[model samples]
Target: MSAARSSGTTRVVILGGAAMGSFCAMSLRDQGFTGPITVVERDPSYARASTALSAAGIRTQFDTPLLVEMSLFGADYLRQTGEIMAFREEGYLVLADAGRAEHRARLAEMQTATGAEVALLDRAELSRRFPHLNTGDLACGTLGTRNEGWFDAWSMLTQARARAREAGVDYLTGEVTGLEAQAGAVTGVVLKDGTTLPCDWCVLAAGAHSAPLVAGLGIELPVVAKKRTAFAFRAPVDPAGLPLTCDVSGFWLRPEGQGFIGGIQPPPERDDHPPEDLEPDHDLLLDLFWPNLAHRVPAMEELRLDRTWAGHYEMNMLDQNAVIGPHDRFGNLVFCTGFSGHGVQHAPAAGRGVAEWIRHGAYRSLDLGPLGWARVRDGQPLSEGMVF
Candidate 1:
């Protein structure tokens, strides 16, 4: 089995039924693949799942052309199912200081050329549009004028699961210990309960937990679980036209109903937090976030800290981009993991790409080769300049 699948798959088993996995199941049905599809998830409630705890923002503000194209497709899909997923087009704004203004302009040029509606705003223009923001120290900003914003991740996950189930994809509750493979081809999935379900094709979309499973099978997947904390707060500023603002001050803030939610990615040295620690990083609010918040938006100085929570970013340390497509050796076993922080938003595109690969032996909609396994194997990282 090569990039073009040798034969049509009969039974497909997907490990980890989160946003990525469930989307694949739904797309499989949409592609008219009438085989037996099974999704194995450790938790049916998705209590600790990344999809359930994410900020659920979607955007077309990627640096890579392939990624920009991928997110554009996802934004379209989410818009078609807008009401179902509570999708909002509030847009995203990323700021750049004097030093990086030139680079930001270059990125905007690249994005706009890829058909993304990006508006590169100077400091004057940025201040005019979002007066509440403290753009005194900023040189420029890029705003996604259309096809960007937030959505309810829980709704997207549950709805996709329900619809995929209704379309005859079996949902199984179990923890997959490892892949059962022989002669470089995945044959079945071994559960913790000692049950082995055979599969003609396997999709390993285990998210942040994908590393260990493939390690046991002699594969290297650099995806890891990194902790990120988001805080909800109430401020006096109106949420009238505030986009999901990524200030020059290291934190991203968005309008979440009557209040707002914001967070910052910890520096690499201090981000080695265990996945099991779901406790809120209240210290961030006191030290980094609070100061930055008040500095970026002057009115936020009078804000009240409502609450805080944490979630694991399924990080691809090597590139910070997604690791998609099949394993170089195990062609029947495709992967849809390692989306870092944008998995939920990009799930629709990833799923459609993977499903098309499994059914038609090649990608029909988006050519997902740029994010494939070969890049990972060769250690050739196609890094994204702006991933927030």
Candidate 2:
């Protein structure tokens, strides 16, 4: 049985139901678009999903102005949904190395220029703010004085999907086998169950699984699944006021429901993975993470080790950034893949921008044309620094 195809109805089928896909559906309905939106998700447990397995944290202090703007917009949306999301303003603290003084100065300048309420603090100020922190070998840090925190990422994702459903977004559970196209435009998607869902617009929000699905249509996307491993530890003492702290070396820690969670990017060679591999690299945590944290905060030596897990980030090879908006060859097909690791925090604004692009053919809030596939095709890189 082949998937059914249609043209009259403005049906929109999204490929994934993680944070980005669900957020796009929610934003479309919020903006009063009455078109039919359908979401397809294969994983019922969502255990291996990035949204669920991430070290749930959010921050607005970024080096790139566009990235900071996107984060601020996302933070604002989270605040507005406090009643629905049960969002807590837990705040975030970013620690830097003294050797990266130039980068620190640049980030401060960018934050101020973008009007982010981020503060640059010296080691003394950091110690004053976080009295428990050991600033023995520190330089400076950037703190999101307000509007930075972590929420139940699972809760946030479920809420967005639920709200989208309430707003008439249909959801299907299956793997995308292929896409149906005509005249270089997407018409519908074929699921593993042989069900064809017709749509006027299609978004490739399938996260790590996007590559194979889109590849079936002969559209070579650069998004590759890169594994990120994280570990959770029970704090020996009450780490209540512990802001989500990210070290200059890319290691980050924050509070989960009952314990403190942390992770660092694996060395570049160790980051690549095959599509089906979901197991975490626990050896990296034992070898690298422990030594790094022990060197920075000796008190962490008392923390009891919790279980570790891994998730995939759909990394774009071109610039190691996101490939947003539509593809050049197929205007009707929208894509928001290759977010590297920042997809969770950037979901809100990216969702809104994608929704507007579908409705108005342009994003009125912020022009995401810079992230379009045209740049990749043209061999240009709008490289934004401070990527973790």
Candidate 3:
């Protein structure tokens, strides 16, 4: 845990030290990156982070094996939460509408391939398993039997930051205004104050802000700020045994302390926004989310609405999947943004995979080639059916 800078040492500068950045920094230390690491974060409060604003849920009930596999690894990390970050396990459930029988079957097939403990429950079984739930409209549901659920995202991320600091990661409060490049190699970064910190490599993990940041270096990333809203409800029924459930319709809810918190994707036009400070419209819950929730679960009619908040999804225009690995053209700059809504859940594995790619020049653990920059250029649509 030494910051002793030596001549010709590989200094790595990371952008945005919230969940993704902090996890990336922790991964670097865990992978034995001994060079000076400086994490520049614009908002240390992390109030607007997708990590904090997320439903804080985890699940392996995804369509793609990579995603399910990544969450499986993430679940293990969450299981060892006490040793790594120390948090409680709440759990997650994915509800499927009668129309989504095909999608449910496909997901179950993928989960089985990965050996994930995702149980495909019929309407009767789902109603019995989750007695509090009104599964009248549900044809089936995929429940994470054991190691799947929601957690204290803020506490987990904060603990990752603490561990990264313990491992010699410097957390600097500043906005990265510019990058220092020499002959197609990243030399350092320029802060808002015009002070330049030289580095051998740079990681653009700036979430929504990453688009403009990378564009500054002539790298045109299609990452846009897609507005998403989240609302909490203090339901009449106890949410104790309830798992974090997402209606196949994309509206999701999970138990948070005494109440349950959740949200749905906004309509198309309302989804895209400029990268700026915008507030959450709680009416999206009543106008959009509630109607759908009621349709999915009849008992949601009795659920009382509580406090709500909103955040931006660093949505990728081309495909909803994340953009990992280095910029194909800019060899020195690594791009780890555009995870859309799945960033928080996939942060641990994504962070470690990118860190490994950075240190070893290839992904030694999980081959994240599906999320590579080549797909963006080749116009390949990823086979991600469940994008919410």
Best by lDDT: 1
Off by over 4 Å in 3: 1-8, 83-90
TM-score to native of every candidate shown: 0.97, 0.93, 0.92
Model 3, CA-based lDDT: 0.78
lDDT of 1 at 129: 88
lDDT tens digits by residue: candidate 3, 1-388 = 1122223377889988988899888998888788888999988998777777876677777777888878888878887776544334545677777788778878787787787887788988887877766777778878777657766788878988999999989999999987877777777788998889897778889987788886667877888877777788876767776777777667888777798788888778666556775588766877878887777666677777677678778888887778887776667677788887777878899899878877777788889888888888788867565666
Q: What residue pairs are clashing in model 3?
A: 81-86, 91-149
Window of ten residues with lowest summed lDDT in model 3: 1-10
Candidate closest to the true structure, highest TM-score: 1
lDDT of candidate model 1 versus the reference: 0.87
Off by over 4 Å in 1: 2-9
TM-score of 2: 0.93
Residues 1-388 of candidate 1: C-alpha lDDT, one tens digit per residue: 5433323448899999999999999999998888889999999888878899999988788878888888798788888886887778889999999998998888889889998999999999988888898888899999998888898899889889989999989999999999888887888899999999998889989888988888878898999998889999899998866789887767989999898999987766778877567777778787888789898888999988888888888899899999888887899989899999888988989999999988888888889999999989999998975655
Error of 2 at 301 (Å): 1.6
lDDT of 2 by residue, 1-388 (tens): 1112222357788989889899989988876677778889888577778888765567777656787788888788888877665566677777777787568867877786786777788888988877666787788888777767876677789888888989888888888888988887888899888889887888889887787887867888887888888888986546677788887767888777688788888897776667768798988877788778766677777778778788887778777677788877777788887887777888888999888888767798978778788987787876765655
